[model samples]
Target: MFTFEIFREEVITCYKEKKQQHKLYSQLENPSPGNLRNLCLIIFSNGLSKEDTQTFNEFFNPLNQSNELETSINRFDLDKLRPLRNFILGKAKNPKDEVVKLLAILVDFQPRPYENWKKSNSTTVIENDNVESGEKDSSEIEAEIPVNTEQAITALNDANSLKSNSKSKYLVVTLGLVLLLGVFLFIKYGTLQKQCMYWNNDRYIAVDCKEKIPGSEVIALDEHKLNNFRRITRPDTLSNKDVSRVWYSKVNNSVEFFTEPGHHPLYDKPLKAVTAYILNQHALEIKN
Candidate 1:
């Protein structure tokens, strides 16, 4: 966890100091831990645009909006982020605006247990280091368990469990919690492929979901089809493929795709027809 309160303060300080917007941008261009990059982008996208909104719009396109959304949600208080939220909301005249999805994902985020531990122990040496020397720091090993992997695995597989082990009395509850949380989050959110849907021209279309926002709509594609799309487009290994963007409308309570490229013929229709087409075509892939 970052010193979110301090970061919020710094952001406010920068704005209040009347630093040139580009100067602020330059300073924020290289923030520590990388997660702060999104906050900076949001600030620039919202604040700096006042001078030349059209140019700003032209320079920072929809694809960049999705890229900012891909960044991880950090531990900032909703109260502190209110200014940014309000700024974004005020600009997003359309409820289906792509920025709305960015805000939604940030608000809906749930930090993991391991993330909590890391934040809590950020300054501690044990938390930052690996047990490479086959030795566990007493502070890190809070529970009386075999610290070695071989011993731990044997203890876990044994019918009697660690009870039969003369070396330790109990399992590492903290370790178990970390592993469980890691696995759960991985299964729940990590396996999603590089697929996303975007709203465009009164309808939706399939696109590269850089942000990988969950529950976004997508054109039904076979594993084979996706591989082919990836091969043909060959998105920058660093970035997502340049494709149309998507949004989630809180009003409609459904994923909205941009009807830009008409990635699928059925997605190019007007609202009603597009909705019906998606319901009919991607029915199997649609989430309940």
Candidate 2:
């Protein structure tokens, strides 16, 4: 019995078969540029039902006047592109489907598929200058339509803001790392290079010198190699006798050496005088 349910089922089966064929077409190994046109022709001739063929003809009749089929395909409305895109997606998702065999024949044909259109509920409203028998002007209709964009606009703004903040953080981190690296290199290499010095004995040494007054203890000629002192006069050049005791006089600002006070007239005067030290070692010894 030819019931309404059976008729509806047959229509559904026809659509399913069309989808399967489209999937095969997408997976073709190599197809000529005219493969889609030829396939459409074949569908018109044999694949489609009489009603479907009639609908297809009505849709494409105006495009027949144009020589460029690609241009006509580009002008396809969302209603027409949705089914084709879904078919291609179905093929991509299922590699082992029997319908994938058609890809071998349609491989050479390249078609640009519609992207992100599946999620949109946007409608294309036609605007005609001439009003139909009872229809109002498209301008008035368009004015009455409300556009919903809050969610999309907010999502887009948030994404852009996040990207900008990420870039700023990356730049700051890179600069900070570079600055730290420079400081580390300076501390390790620059300070060592500056510390190097040549001693009076023609030997290299790292002298730990500091700023001080010339007459202070820190500036004295000493045995330590790291000291900043330099020997100006030798001990032997100052006196011929053995002078064990050395005193520095503030009035003369010179080193005065004292030998045993013998019965010499020069005992009141210094036996040896040098241009460098100033110290009262006798008081320190008595105190100790």
* Each prediction's whole-model lDDT (CA): 0.35, 0.35
Quick one: how many clashes does candidate 1 have?
Answer: 10
Clashes per model (N, Cα, C within 3 A): 10, 8
Candidate 2 per-residue lDDT over residues 1-288, each given as its tens digit: 233333323333444554454433321212333334434443332344444433444444444765543334334443543333334444334332112222211221121011112112122112122223113333344344444577556655655665566568679989999999999998767755334333333212453445332332232222222332233233343331212222222224443332211111112343332223222232223224
The alpha-carbon RMSD values of the candidates against the true structure, listed in the order shown, are: 19.0, 42.6
Q: What lDDT tens digits, residue by residue, belong to model 1 across residues 1-288?
A: 464443333333444343332223222333332323344344442343232333223233433443342231222223433434443334323332223323322222222122332455465655346433223333233354488998776655552432344134224656688899999999756856534554333433446555443455555433322321111111111111211121111123443433121233233333221233343333324432
Clashes of 2: 8
Give the lowest summed-lDDT range of ten residues in model 2.
109-118
